[model samples]
Target: MTLPEKPASGAEQPTMAELAEGYASKAGLHRSSNGNIDVLKSAGGVQGIAESVLPGLVFLVAFTITRDLPVALIGSLATAAAFTIARLIQRRPLTQALAGVVGVGLSAWLANSTGKAEDFYVLGFFTNVAYILAMALSIAFRWPFAGLIFGFIRNEGLEWRKHPARMKAYKIGTWVIISVLVLRLVVQVPLYFMGEAGLAALATTRLLMGAPLYILGVWVAWLLTRPAPAPADPGTERS
Candidate 1:
């Protein structure tokens, strides 16, 4: 484990996009499957790697690089839970509720403190928030992103039979993120020795990248569920 295990510090992680892509692969009519067995399928070795650990490590990596504001880490989890509440309002999943809080908090963060209301840094803050939220949603809800692979399946990918998958993924994501955090906190080894300036650059870039990554991830998820066509009409129904 390292210092970047938490969300606030893990901006420099390279795999954030990769890991997030898995979840993003299931959007719209193609949400993550509610099959607890599938998620737990990879319980040993390869499966173990996929289910028990990798997910959290990915988050920790992002959290590690995105380091700086401890508040954002708490913000990440709080906002996620908040999103679940929002979904409950509309009868959606916890991820939807998490999205709401993310949107609000991030929109505000993006609003900027440019000494005047005139300075609307729209792209800077909100974009970053969006990216973090996309990845965070997976963490918040606890599901494995099967990408196009899972898309072929019947269930739109959403709705885990049990909420246990949510906790498993969350714990896994959080654990890995925590490990990265330990490295940064204990050894104080940064991706780059940006000192104050380098560290600042890392966070800013992460915010910038977060949006596009989210868009791509969501888009891919949709493409996977573009809707298979029905078979040709049969003559039997010609009454």
Candidate 2:
């Protein structure tokens, strides 16, 4: 009796070996040093960092000097607007600048309308809470946000979830990110309740923890998901 032949590579469903090879290659591409740099670049690099922090810094300084809410709010909003305008003029991406403007505007409105300086940080605090909730849900569903992001970056769809090892790696990475967000809330929430001095503390906390902590989390996620180095080829092995 003639035995049945196995399907050709292109005609067959991907074997475990093929899946692993593809997954490893994609993960290596995304978890490289350059990929880490891309994370910072997406956050608007040096200029983006400045755009994010400067307006808040200006507000804090103005508030400290004048102790006048309206004056401080105006200073902050003006700085945000100027950054946005500059980005527009330079033909750079407006995402960071525009986000800064909206954030500062909402913050200013809240602080001014309520006559409570601490209210300025309310939006940010709640935004963190929302992120925590979303991340928690993703983890519970076994469709981690980190995995989704990795898949999106690789343009490889959701195939990573099919591999038990990769799925676990993504789950761990997502938890790491969730931990960072939770830590922010744990530290910042108490300060938000303290009124004026608390607002100052909150602002300082935000400046200190914001981008640095985020970058650290990204690095940690990359480390967790990075593929193991491939085994050396027998032909290329050193004697």
Candidate 3:
């Protein structure tokens, strides 16, 4: 069966297999002499970002309108529905939305039972994390020997042998953690300098801001994780 392809200019889109093989060929050009590093970039930048972010925007707008946590959550669910409807209307893929609903629901249920409400953000966070990990997991499953680890979402079938200290993955993950922490600070920093009105505005702004970050994370995920390309040779990396 044909996998989906990016739309072309005034021409029919290529099949998913075509796109996959095309990416494979493009990736083949950038191999390290030692055959360890696998570079990745996503082709579905604009479209994927839009699809991913739509739900977040809906949730944020709903939060603004509702102004109550539980009601805002219901609004978030409605936002998800709206996102699904819009995707159907546009004929975009529904896999992301469907998966988001399931993943978000599960995460919410689990967090409520075992973790604090602080553990839960909008569904965007869970959706993006799940989607991105799906890509990495795909790579890990496909090829365990490219000397690489945690292939970013594209899962370009890199050969990952363990590094001396697993330093690279640690570095990337560390930066991601730091960046998230800094962003949380950016959100909270204003509280110190704000009046009642300022605090209200700050809260509103954060409530609204989540949509874009979550969507951007989702978009990044699509890029970071794509389907693994088939191995061309016995020695070639598959993950």
Over 4 Å off, model 1: 1-76, 95-195, 214-239
Model 3 C-alpha lDDT per residue in residues 1-239, reported as the tens digit of each score: 99997767789766543544455444321223333222321222444444444444454455456644455445556656666787799898777667656654553554355433332343334444554555455444543211122332124224222442333433344334334434644664465245333534544554545434433433343333333465688656554
lDDT computed for candidate 1: 0.38
Worst 10 residues of 1 by lDDT: 112-121
What digit string (tens of lDDT, one per residue) describes model 2 on residues 140-177? 99999888766555444688888888888889988998
Write down the lDDT of every candidate, Cα atoms only. 0.38, 0.79, 0.44
Using TM-score as the measure, what is the rank order of every candidate, best first?
Answer: 2, 3, 1
Name the lDDT value of residue 214 in candidate 3: 38
Q: Which numbered prediction scores highest in TM-score against the true structure?
A: 2
Candidate with better lDDT, 1 vs 2: 2
Each candidate's number of clashing pairs is 56, 0, 19
What is the lDDT for 106 in model 2? Answer: 98
TM-score of 1: 0.26
Q: TM-scores for all candidates?
A: 0.26, 0.81, 0.38
